[model samples]
Target: MTRKILHVDMDAFYASVEQRDNPDYKGRPVIVGGPPDSRGVVCAASYEARKFGVRSAMPCSQAARLCPSGIFVTPRFEAYRKVSSRIREIFLEYTDLVEMLSLDEAFLDVTENKKNIPYASQVAKEIREKIFEETRLTASAGVSINKFLAKVATDQNKPDGMTIVRPDQVEKFIESLDVGVFPGIGKVTLKKMHALGIRNGKDLKDKSLEMLDQSFGKSGRWFYAVCRGLDDRPVEPYRERKSLGAESTFPKDLENSEEILRELADIAEELERRLLKKPFPGKTITLKVKFSDFTQKTRSLTEDYTYIDKNELYRIGSKLLGEFLLGSGKSVFPIRLLGLSLSHPESSSKITTVNTEEEDDLFPSLF
Candidate 1:
């Protein structure tokens, strides 16, 4: 069976919407995030801002430093959600096999499309055109045989562009890619691969399956498969929210115990707000912290009761934080970031294994 997948990603969705609404924002650096002085990060940055090294998830203060004249716009999530819903409607006109990775990006199976377009490339182009015509925003699409290649292709030529990777091109394409381009290969994993002298796909493929398994443990098999252009994951129209989380990076490293708890209290409120939209009713509460030096750690607690109260979330999360910090309930080191999330549904506590769908570390969730 012919498998045709397309990954579509909006170009700076939040920033673009801001620019599109305001004429003066065009051709200027627009960073859609919190105030520069605030302890919030950039949610999305325009391509103009990106040229100055500004990017999503970067601290707003740093983004300001990078793009001195960057226009910082507070996120209008409701507006973005409306645009995202419109885009989803556009995708459904082509195929129902649409898997939304986030509000601004999705994976689409256009192998059997409503338009009956024989060439996947043409379908991708049509989708991009339709998105622009309707939303007044541009999109990028990558067309290939599987979700992996399709997602990667979407990033190749961005900002209203489309790329097609044919069957014959798949092998060469996979072999020529940098190891960092593969999904799940985060900065830590990429650094480890570099230390092991596996810089590119060719180098990674040279190692035997046994060697890879030894090196990467469970993820080794995934690496062993994708390096040779092999991925069979299908596009599902719906996906259950594995976890719902909200996190923030402080403008200054927090050292005071009171201050830390206050921040945790705020995060719990935000998480509570997000969860209320689509209640998870989870039994596990996890706390994530990033120290001043960028070292990260997580502590979780599974209680008998379900997660419903913000006060309880803060109570349990603070307890976990206290345990992690240790010694008189005070921190020896400064804390720069704090995150709270709920997972492990009441029915089951099993939450370890992560596929692509489960591995969004960037405040990434619909729930």
Candidate 2:
């Protein structure tokens, strides 16, 4: 049976939410994330801001320079989370086979939908409409026979658009697509593909599987299949989360032990709040540090049991920090970023205890 997939992406999610809540922000450029003067990056840029070439993951400083009149807003995760929950609720009304890619996007397999919708495109339309009717925010959707094509269709016409690729049209759609537009094809990989004269799906499809594997390894196999519109991956609703963590990048690097410890205390406090909200019982604590030169190191210690207290998290984080200092001979100091995570959960049974939080446990930043 052919699987009918729909990918729904909230347009400029953070910035859009800010605009929806603030009447003054309407029709104006809004940037959400860190302050422009800080070492923060753009989490989301409004359509108005995107006209100035501001984009998510770009430095906030650069975003400010690109659109000097843009309004910079700190991320209010709680508000975004509420909106995300509502969006997920709308998705569930259509199909239980919903795979949330992030707080702002999800993939739904509506082949056997709760609504018993005949066409996936009509389901996409209704979902988008219901989302806007409930939240006053817009979403773009892509409907196709598989996840890859659906995701690609979502981006073809973004920020309040819908694109559908029928089974018969999938071949032409894949053949004409630029390789860079495919997921996981980053700049470095694009350059490699360019070196091999693989500019689009047509070029990619010309390569033999053996040649692709020899060039790009496992991802080569993925490209080979996706180029032919043969993605067989299902929309998994119950994906396992491997870790839960948070990190902060400072405006300036910290040099002394006192400053480092102080920063870790703040991070531990943040992690504690997250754990309390979505209690994941894990036996491991990992500390990650990145230097001003971009070099990074991670230290992890897994205990026999899970950490349930805030003080314990701080203690373990401090211990890891000390170990990193001693092990690196203080060479990794003047750190620009610090992060902490808890992993190796006690069991899948423990996951059921986590309430209100999404399934994915990587970090807060989806992009």
Candidate 3:
């Protein structure tokens, strides 16, 4: 069946919430993260900040350099979560097939909506309006025949805008679509594709499956299909979150063992903060490392206890990194990325609701 899909994305959600709550922050570049002098990374950046080259996951120091007058605010996830719940309720009025990707975005299969809306774009428009009316926040939406198209369309006209990708326009649309704009293609891959003279969907489609396989390995088939506007991935409403993690790719490759360990320590620390906030309580702590050559290695250690301790996690992660560095037999130093994750959720720990302030107001800034 040609399903009707909608990708609804909140506009600079956390930063937007901060702006909404504090009118003074409204038109300014609001960045949600630690102070500028700290070694913390930016969690979110408003569109205003984007103009100054500030972006999420960028170091606060760099963001400060980019946008000197940017207002930095600590994240209030609980506040954002409340707003998200209100928006989700508005969505359920139209359809039950809602798949949330995060607190700020979701995929909605409105092929057979509860409201029985015939046109997907109308459903998208109504949903966006309802979200704004209820939460006092703007959301952008994309309506299309499939999930991939719908998702890409969501970014076309962003920050309270809607874009529809009709089935008839899919071919022409895909022809000029930039490979870099595709979700899964990272900076390195985009550079490689550019080197191969494959800049857009048409260029990508020109390659043989064998060529893609030789270049991207098993991911070649996926690239081949998506470049042709073909994606059969289904949006499952009850998709379980298997893990929670934090990772950072360095602007330049890190070669020193101390530098790699230092980055891993920071990643571990960030993971702990996220764990306390998300409360997944998984027993497994995993360390994932990527080399300068783009090869990846992962080491996992499962603890008997359900909850993770910050010290214990960093210890294990550092040890894991040390083991990889010694065992890989690479005399020279370059590690491209460092990641840490908590997985294999605790059997007894179902996600608890945050009703009262004492219950889940975990952020110090909120207090």
Q: TM-score: which candidate is best?
A: 3
Error of 3 at 358 (Å): 46
lDDT of 2 by residue, 53-111 (tens): 99776668889899999999998989999999999999999899999877888999999
**lDDT for each residue of candidate 1 in 136-201, tens digit (9 for 90 to 100):** 999999999998888788878888888888889988888788888786564445666888899888
| Pairs of colliding residues, candidate 2 | none
| Best-to-worst lDDT order | 2, 1, 3
Compute the lDDT of residue 327 as modeled in candidate 2: 51
Candidate 1 residue pairs in backbone clash = none
Clashes of each: 0, 0, 1
Instruction: Report the error of model 2 at residue 289, Å.
Output: 18
Clashes of 1: 0
TM-score of each: 0.73, 0.70, 0.75
**Cα-lDDT of candidate 2:** 0.79
Residue 275 alpha-carbon offset, candidate 2, angstroms? 18
Write candidate 3's Cα lDDT for 154-184 as tens digits: 8889989999989889888888888887765
Local error of candidate 2 at residue 307 (angstroms):
19
RMSD of 2: 10.2
